[model samples]
Target: MPWVFLVIAGLLEVVWASLMKESHGFTRFWPSLGTLVFMAGSFGLLAVAMRTLPLGTAYTIWTGIGAVGAFLVGILWLGEPAGALRLLAALLIVSGLVLMKLTSGH
Candidate 1:
């Protein structure tokens, strides 16, 4: 289903983003290649999902998932700060994502 593809795409975005950080401005080899591979996969799935899902809803949800996912990844695995403000921002993003999905016809 389109939703399935979209969710996978969003997850792939997370993977690629993490890998991209590991890539260190493309100075690395394996991580840089992994970033490209996952980036392609994410884009491909986004295109597939877009065939049915509305552009605004799908794109917003996709970015929202990626942003929130990256936030968690950064805080948990990357030793980034998880202050109350940052946590609140992530929660707000999630809330918006839920609202967007609920309002979507698909």
Candidate 2:
């Protein structure tokens, strides 16, 4: 299903984002390669899902997942701050994503 593809794409987006950070501005060889591979995968799935999903909805959800996922990953694994305001912002992004999915009509 397109939704399934989209969700997978979003998750891959998260992986790519984390890998990008690990790449150290593409200085690290392995992480840089991994970033490119995952980025391609995420984009491929996104294009497939876009065949049916609305542009705005698909894009927003995809980026929302990436943003929130990367945020959590940073906090959990990269020693990034998990400040209250940052957590609230992530929560708001999630809320918006839920609303977008519900009203997508596809």
Find the candidate with the highest TM-score and give its number: 1
**Candidate 2, which segments miss by more than 4 Å at Cα?**
none
State candidate 2's TM-score. Answer: 0.97
lDDT tens digits by residue: candidate 2, 1-106: 9999999999999999999998999999999999999999999999999999999999999999999999999999999999999999999999999999999998
> Per-residue lDDT of 4-102 in model 1, one digit per residue for the tens?
999999999999999999999999999999999999999999999999999999999899889999999999999999999999999999999999999
Off by over 4 Å in 1: none
Best by lDDT: 1
Q: Per-residue error at 73 for model 1, in Å?
A: 0.6
TM-scores, all candidates, are 0.98, 0.97
lDDT of 2: 0.95
- How many pairs of residues collide in each model? 0, 0
